[model samples]
Target: MRDTNFLIENNAKAIWHPMAHPADMRARPPKVMMRGSGVHVSDIEGRTLLDAVAGLWNVNLGYSCDPIKRAISEQMDALPYYSGFRGTSTGPSIQLAYELAEWFEPEGMVRSFFTSGGSDSVETALRLARQYWKIKGQSDRTKFLALKRGYHGTHFGAASVNGNANFRRNYEPLLPGVFHIPAPWTYRNPFNETDPAKLAELCAAALADEIEFQGGDTIAAFIMEPVLGAGGVIVPHESFMKLVREICDKHGILMISDEVVTGFGRTGAWSGARLWGVKPDMMTIAKAITSGYFPLGATLIGEKMAEVFEADKSGLASIGHGYTYSGHPVGCAAGIAALAETRRLRLNENAAARGSELRQALLALQSRHPIVGDVRGQGLMAALELVEDQTTKKPLDKAKMADVAAATYEADVMIRVSGNNIILSPPLIVSAADVEKIAVALDVGLLSAV
Candidate 1:
């Protein structure tokens, strides 16, 4: 067995984790994961911990999945890599696209374009929105809008369109012409109303006003997460999404749903867009697409937008798009297997069932812990907003919350905290019992911190 000190030292010397301060991390020397199985992971010391965030909101099939492994192995042996250019395609790439198009039908129009990951896929959507409007003879429509606190990804275009302060603030002067409006967070409603309908109107009207102020002709599209994942797992009011859809339609703005975190059974449906019955003009998907078994993301376009490209078939006007590893064979194979596994096991139904149990348990904790300001979510994705006072709904100290989150990791339950809110997005394969253990671990950590 490898020496524990050696492993920790090596990781500290070489590896850099996302969203972590390297200096402070050296003192703790990050937990080195040796292996994972089902909903648990083992460190170098053979200590097991329940995986609550599902490996950064992917790994929907849990760890050590045999089917996905076999599928990937078979494809790698046959043809591991290929380009989707010049009329060439691989088996898994073709099959998975067709399957997903069929699955997400009736709610959103569809056609798939592959990328290496979520950020790239989101960039593709933003660029496509501009190009589609151009093809429709509306070249002035170049501006893009997203909700505040929304996290699309880290790429230039995606980051610009994303509304996360920390993600964009450091990297200033992001892509020009991107705008942001208030998110539909009912808990701390900007409208100062508790009613869902009023809150929905308040949020959608904010977007409408922004579009009008900027001149509708200059705005290309509006992108948003159906259930704000990284942004505190904020679920929109009941009628909010529909109103957003109506506003987009009225202004001829293409709707791009960034379902990177909420897609593929995360919200007890094939896509959260389907759960809410919102017909987006386009979709950017990743995460559970391959259950984190491989790096893959896709941009799904509506039929109306596809026709614009279809009409430009004359090879004269260029579409200037594509990644070197666009339709990777192994990633596609993993995606196919992941989708098949999710369907066969009825993972969406499981998420809804387990999520219901999680809600009740979390709400019960609210009665006991004032630090848990609010509990909100749908299906398997959820959040516990930590607060200083329950009555005033004052958020806990940001640094203190981060400390609590870091401590929870030591407790052997990997839960993520976004801006004072403990975000829990376990794998779709997570069982009811696993949910209970995760919640209990979180409670212990929070109480200890308080």
Candidate 2:
């Protein structure tokens, strides 16, 4: 094995990180994680830190999930590689599809179109949505509507619907006819509305207005995260998603719940749609499907979508898009094991209890620290928005966030610092003690930033 110093030296030099500047890497070298156990990871320097980001919001079962590892190894030995593109199929993939159908049955998702990861799942969902409209002979229904702070994925199709400018600006000339509506974020919204129910109604009215302006027949789908993830863990009002569903139904537009981050129990329910008591037309899911043991995702279809795709004799109904690894047997095998463990352990229940505790702790931290301007979350996914002034709600600069993040690491907990928000999504397997540790670490970090 190479020495720690050697690996650390080549970390930033060897690879270009997806969402980071090349120059910034030189200013602050990245940490090289050598190992993970339970909820803690060890850096190359042998410093073990509690992981609150859950390996980019995957790793639901934690690092030492023996069942998933065993499942992957067992499947690899049986069938190392096979394609699920049309004529070919794998056993694990078939079983997984059936399992997913059962798992998301409550959400009305009856079918699963597998993908390689979250981005692929999102891309697949968008394409399927447009295709759904085409099959219905409403070819003009090609536009998409999304929330302003939503993060769909990186593909041109996905990026087109993504509301965040940071994800869209550099990749201009993206798919046209995609529009955005204001997110029902009480902390910061154009309406300045603080009440959740009223905010939800206003956001829903905005969606209806956009559909009216664009002509409802011209809009294919309204895509949104049940709980906005990458843009910051902004948990919408309980009524927001339900209201969106009602509007989409009235407009005859499909609802695509981008559950890439909120899927598989991160949001205290089996899925975020269930959390809000809404059943979407399609759901783009990944992340916890295989619990980070493998790269796997799927665009889950509702019964209505199934009927359209199945009943169609038209060539337009044929799915032209598919990844080479649409349903890799090993990935599906890991998913089966992960899902089983997820259910057996009832991670959703744990997430609910832990999430409530964590949120209260964050509220306490907010009371003590003036820097914490806003605290938002649902279930295990949470974020603290740092600000220069609580009254003005002026966001704290990146330098200060970085300092706080560094301090959190010094306190032996790793957190994700995005823009001015400090995001925390610890593994679902975390216990009460673990939650306390995370809260204490954040308290220390907040102190440094203050």
lDDT of each: 0.86, 0.92
Scored by lDDT, model 1 comes in at 0.86
In candidate 2, which residue pairs clash? none
Predicted model with the maximum lDDT: 2
Pairs in steric clash, model 1: none
Q: Give, for candidate 1, the lowest lDDT window spanning 10 residues.
A: 310-319
| Candidate 1 lDDT over residue span 1-450, tens digit each | 767777766777676778877886776777778899998988887888888889999988999789999999999899988888877988888998898789778755568999999999999999889888777778899999889989999999988987788898888988999889988887886677777677778888999999999998899999999999888888887687888899999999999988898888888877878888899999999889889999999999888887778888655236588998888999999999998898998888989999999989899888888788889989988999988888898889977897777777777898887787888988888887898898788777787657
lDDT tens digits, residue span 1-450, model 2: 888668877879878888999889877888889999999999988899999999999989999999999999999899988987759989999999999999999999999999999999989998998899899998998898999989998999988888899999998999999999999999998999999889999999999998899999999999999999888888889999999999999888999999999998999999999999999999999999999999999999999999989999878898899998999999999999999999999999999999999999999999999999999989999999999999998999888888898999999999999889999999999999998999999999988876
> Which regions of candidate 1 are displaced past 4 Å?
1-5, 313-317
* RMSD (Å) of each candidate, 1 decimal: 1.7, 0.9
Highest-scoring model, TM-score: 2
